[model samples]
Target: MTEILVVGASIAGQTLAYWLARHGMRATLVERAPRLRTGGNGVDLRDEATEVAARMGILPRVRAAAADVRGMKFVDAADRAVARVNMSRNGEIEIMRGDLVGLLHEVAEPEVEYVFGDSVRSMEEDAGGVTVSFEGGTTRRFDLVVGADGLHSSVRRLAFGPEEGALRHMGHYFAFANADSALGEDRWVTMYNLPGKMAGLYRSGNHAQAKAYFIFRSAPLAHDHRDAEQHRTLLKEAFGHETSWRVRELLDGALADPDFYFDALSQVHLPSWSSGRVALVGDAAYCASPASGAGAELAVVGAYRLAEELAGTSDHQIAFRRYEEGHRELVKRKQQIGPNVRMMVPKTHLGMWARNGLALSMGLLARSS
Candidate 1:
């Protein structure tokens, strides 16, 4: 039995573990969090990823957990709808990120061993196997080690090298948290865009709770990613004075929420995703950035193809190469859309007006088609 150690129990890690175990490989998944993280904003299953989900026999569950959003409305500071785009016909299904993660965990638990509240501190690969030391002061050996950890992957840093690749910051940062649905809206996402800033609210179809998103353009702030207090202060300092509808209230609610996630909107560009017996997947390898709206899709499909390649080949070298070759085109296509962030998050009043006009025109064209 080939023993595999997978770092980061996010969607990618869980999915990869499931496939690997099904292929007669033993996989142990480790997550830094003590339990499954929940209450994230909705993410879409689009393109080839939909087929991948169906093959995994989770399409029905995924569809059942979808946000059921009919459309998204762009609103002005005064809360008037400037444009609306019907999302039902977008050929994609959206589900809360936490719900999808939970579903994947449920399916993977029976087949894979899980270690929570622990992380890989160091790794050493030898001729026979890879030895990994955990932060909890324990060492283990595995036939292979996989880094499914998100963009700031500890496995990548320990195995590949200190992040040599460029982390292209998209001149913005985003934060999301669960909050009270005081906006009294459902079945639609409301968005407000200002100069180099954006605020939005999304109400879940299955729960009365809502998710709030905030973005602003600024130099990268120096703070620990795990520090929620610093994250709250940064958000407040950035948008505390803004007069957008219920902005202060939402900020207060977000800071008070225990599960707030804050990070820069950035893409991880790497020359290669693998360095020997260790490899990377999902955002750890090629994050097209959340602005591209393809992270979840890429994660699911990439994990599937990666596990398939590994199962088909005995040589890790050949398997990693084939995985990169098979998936690089999709990564390139997704990264090509990075330049569109300016249009998506306009930086001036005139730019916002232009964006609103373009969106309205597109909405009209979509309706006609």
Candidate 2:
């Protein structure tokens, strides 16, 4: 029997465990959080990943967990609709990130060992296997170690190197937090764009609380990703010039939110996803920067493919190479975010007006269909 240690019990880690179990290999999972994480904004499922979910026997549960959000209504500062972008336009379903994670956890639990509230401190590899040290004071050896963790992955840092130059910051920032549902319409996401900034509220028929969003364009600023107060202050400074469309109210909600998630819009672009007895998966290897709308897909599909390759061989190095070769092209395409950034936060007021026109056209097409 081959033993493997998977880090980060996120979408990627859960899917990886499920597929690895099916492939006749079970693994232990470690998460930094005290328990399962249940706080996050909306996420989508699409592409080949849809099939992966079905094969895992969780597609129905995923469909049932849909947020039931109709679409996004781009609004002006006066709280009037300018145009709408239909959610169902892409033939994909949107589920809350937490809900999806939970579903994956539920399905993968019995077949896996879970270590919560702790994380990897350091790792050392040898001819026999890789030995990992945990922050909680323990060491373990395994035939393979996979970092299914997110962008700031400890395994990637230990196995590969620092992430300073590997990350491509998209010259923008975005944040999301719980909001008062009454502030937004049921089943709709209300968005307001002004020049280089965007503010929005997402309300779903199934959720009692809506989610608030704020995005702005700027060069990289010095800040800690883990500091919520610092993030709120920076957001205030960035949106200081805007007095439009509930910016004040959204900011207030964000500050009050205990689960606020704020970060620079960035993608991870690494030269390779593997080294020696360790390898990386999902955002740790190739994050599409959230703007690509492919995080969930990439995470699941990449894990599934890695399991497929590893199942056929004892040579994990070759399996890692095969996984990279199989998934690298799509990763490259998804990391191209210039057009996505321009669409996300227009550089000028005139550009926003143009965006409004484009939205209206898309809405019209949806209606006609």
Candidate 3:
């Protein structure tokens, strides 16, 4: 059996390991978090990703746990819905990120060795295999190493060099945390915008708890990505003074939540997904950004494809090249992202009015049709 090391145990890493083992390869997954990071915003699964989930026998579970969000409603300060954009598409299923992660874990845990609360510290690659040093002070060797880690991947830095050249800031930062369910209508994502910022509440009919999310336009700010306190401070500075449209209540609740997620709206644009015996998958190599709504889809399909390629060949180089070649077109299309940012956070009052008007027109057209 070929030995493989997969970094990060979220959707991508778990899916990769599961597929790898199914193909008669041995996989060990390492996660920096002590446990699974299941708290996150809703993610969508469509097209090839949905097919992949079906093959894994988790499609029914995913559908059952679907967020069931009807669509997005743009609201005013007085809490009246101005326009609603129906986000439901025929072939897509939306589920809370945490729920999906848990489901993936249930399927992957049996066949894969998991190392939580530790991470890869360094790696030395040679003709035989790659020697890995873990943060928990252990050394191991694997025929191949893959970084399914998120955008700020340690393996990418270790193998492909620093991320500065590959990371593209999308002119904004966003945060997501728990919120009071009563703040928004059930089964709807309610959003309010002020110039270049948006504060929203996502209320799923299947979930008792709600999620508060905020996005603000900004140039990149220098800060430690792992510092929770710094994330809170930055969030406060961005929306602390806003007294409109339930912003204060949402902010308060978000700050109180321990698992607040804050990150720059960024994408990874790597020239190559692999270096030597090391390779990258999912957000570690090509993040389309949240605005694209393709993170989960890309993660699932990319991980599966990577594993499939590796299983088909003994040559890691050939496998890595084939994986990238097969997946790059989808990544390229999703990375376009287009006007999603502008639509979410209009830069001016006139722009907001125009957006609202367009949405209202679309809603009316759909109703008449």
Predicted structure with the largest TM-score when compared to the true one: 3
For residues 252-350, what per-residue lDDT tens digits would candidate 2 score against the true structure? 878888888889988998888999989899998898987888888889999999999999889988999999999998778767755766875788989
Off by over 4 Å in 2: 358-369
Instruction: Indicate whether candidate 1 or candidate 3 has the larger lDDT.
Output: 3
Q: How does candidate 3 fare on TM-score?
A: 0.98
Candidate 1, backbone clash total: 0
Scored by CA lDDT, what does every candidate get? 0.84, 0.86, 0.94
Each prediction's TM-score against the native?
0.95, 0.95, 0.98
**Which tens-of-lDDT digit does each residue in 182-220 have in candidate 3?**
888999999999999999999998999999999999999
Worst ten-residue run, lDDT, model 3?
360-369
Candidate 1 local lDDT, 182-243, one digit each (tens): 77368878778878888888876776788888888887768787788899899988889987
Which segments of candidate 3 are over 4 A away from where they belong? 361-369
Point out where model 1 deviates above 4 Å: 164-166, 338-340, 362-369
